[model samples]
Target: MNWKKSLRAAGLVTALTFSLVGCNTEGSYSPQEIIDHALQETKEPLTYYGEYTMDMGEAGGKAQVKEWSKDGKRRIETISENGEHNIAVNNGSQIIMYDVVKNTVHKIDISKDGLDDFPSQRDQLEILFNTVKDTHDVKIAGEEKIAGRDTYKIVAKAKKNDTLIGDIEVWVDKKTWVTLKTITNSAGNKMTTEYTKLDDSAKIDDAQFTIDIPKDAKVEEISVPESESVKLDTVKEQLGEFLMVPEENGLTLDGISLDKGIEDRSEYTFNYSKNGQQNISVTVFKANSNANKVEPVFGEKEMDIRGQKGSVMDENKFRSISWQENGYQYSIFIGNSELTIEDLVTYAKQMTIVK
Candidate 1:
């Protein structure tokens, strides 16, 4: 329970259960109907305290979480191993995160920063359900009892064998439609999160949604720079030379966006689309010369493109090829396309850095 070490893993559970309000609806519903009802029920404001456990095959941890939300305002407090307390409060406009051990607070402006929607129970569920509904096959796995409550077990299995999400099983409470337990298998590793105690009827004070930072604590402002859309010539003027257009492949330049990179560098993205449906992007950026060379991940294989050795990573949703050339790293991503590894390599071979 090193709080700092286990904070991220515990935060996932907190995000998934931030504002689950129960509904009064009754009657048997299809698995999708139940999920839809649960997603809709999250629109109401409620408070809850629960104990969550996360078990990965090799590592696992637990945390105590208390959350309160009304309207768009939210506050979540997580106490993990070593009594590490992390507090996050979103007052509709800005998000403030306090680290108790470090005695510091970080504030982020949601609108100005282009941040994703605040992690409300509704938002989290929407993202989870939408991703699975389109890519995975969903069905009812039966019924079970979780934490003394009746629940319907719903299973979502990946449609393709190469997907990162192998399978996910969720036990939805019959009365509240809240997820009591979730088991996810990805990349041959299983992780399960279960709520041992759920108190949705608890009285939450207004003070719980506000954080009282010590006067001596330091405050830091975090800003996320906006991505800049630029033309190809502008990119070449900055990075000298990189990949050019490949009109031969029926790929046309859709747009280019630039963003801040690590170590004060810049990242350039070249977006290409085919028939306005299929999209392929080539991203080029600098890497530290002394940094360890990139290695292939699971399911990646060695390949050669334009005399440069690289690796091709093939997954269910997207296919990517990455390599280092002329002191810069380049990666090409093809999303939901029928392009083969050889097809991608052919495109990679045509990339040239202008002098």
Candidate 2:
């Protein structure tokens, strides 16, 4: 056997192996495949523990946070700038919050709280990738290490019709496909979020979702009044020609509800929203019996709407205009928008009775 020749051959094999491994790590993935992998949610919910820091840029201050999620349940702890601790524990059906600074425990039932299911971070990524995968140009910027794991740097840029949300860059874990960090630069403001520590395999139990309260702490239970989603026809049948929908066709009617309170008066809420960002709630009051009458709030502006006097009030960037007409009390509530009292009055005057 030729010893020198054998050593050279072994070195050549080792170099080839290293080259192939390097190629598989960086150059083997396409941007679309990376997006697809990021979009895929694991069927089995993973047990993980992580600590993260959020920099809100100039819009808000910074915060330190810790999170533990397992088996469709999670516990989150946040520390504010003033050294106050806020902790929230969600066990899928109920939520328990224990304020360390105030020593209070607040319990809320999921069904009775009137809170909608918010999309998770993964879900939001799925939505963005799905919506902009074809419209926006995406590329693999490079690879980097994040939170002690190898990640693929994916960058997607919005092309046209932009606003506060501009271009985005994300670093996703190579193995778990979880987003480890994200950077966004929009409208001259930059926001960044990254997991400073992450552990995908953690020993988490069911007891981790419950919090301990102090002996002298105050406890409060919050529950909303029962409300049902009723159809538009059902509302029109009860009260003929109800004025709920706005004249704006771009905003669609997304939520409709009837709150059966005290069995004598019914409260109807019609929610109109555009892109889930802006909303207008048209709340109509109807009396099942003839004993209830809607009264105008005192000290509000008196405006005319279809020959009826309406009370208008604007406080804390929320505007409400209420008027009694056709045996019903109609109130339009709008918040955080550019619409004014006069604009609402015109809409109210233009409201056609649905027959």
Best by TM-score: 1
Residue 83 error, candidate 2, Å: 1.6
Query: Which pairs of residues collide in model 2?
Result: none
The segments of candidate 2 whose C-alpha lies over 4 angstroms from its true place after superposition are: 1-27, 111-116, 131-135, 185-189, 224-355
| C-alpha RMSD for every candidate | 4.8, 17.2
Give the least accurate 10-residue stretch of model 1, judged by summed lDDT.
1-10
Least accurate stretch of 10 residues (summed lDDT) in model 2?
Answer: 14-23
What digit string (tens of lDDT, one per residue) describes model 2 on residues 175-215? 77767777765433566777888787788878889888789
Query: Over all chains combined, what TM-score does candidate 2 have?
Result: 0.58
TM-score of each: 0.82, 0.58
For model 1, the superposed segments whose C-alpha errors exceed 4 Å read 1-24, 41-43, 46-49, 55-60, 111-119, 129-137, 158-163, 187-189, 293-301, 335-342
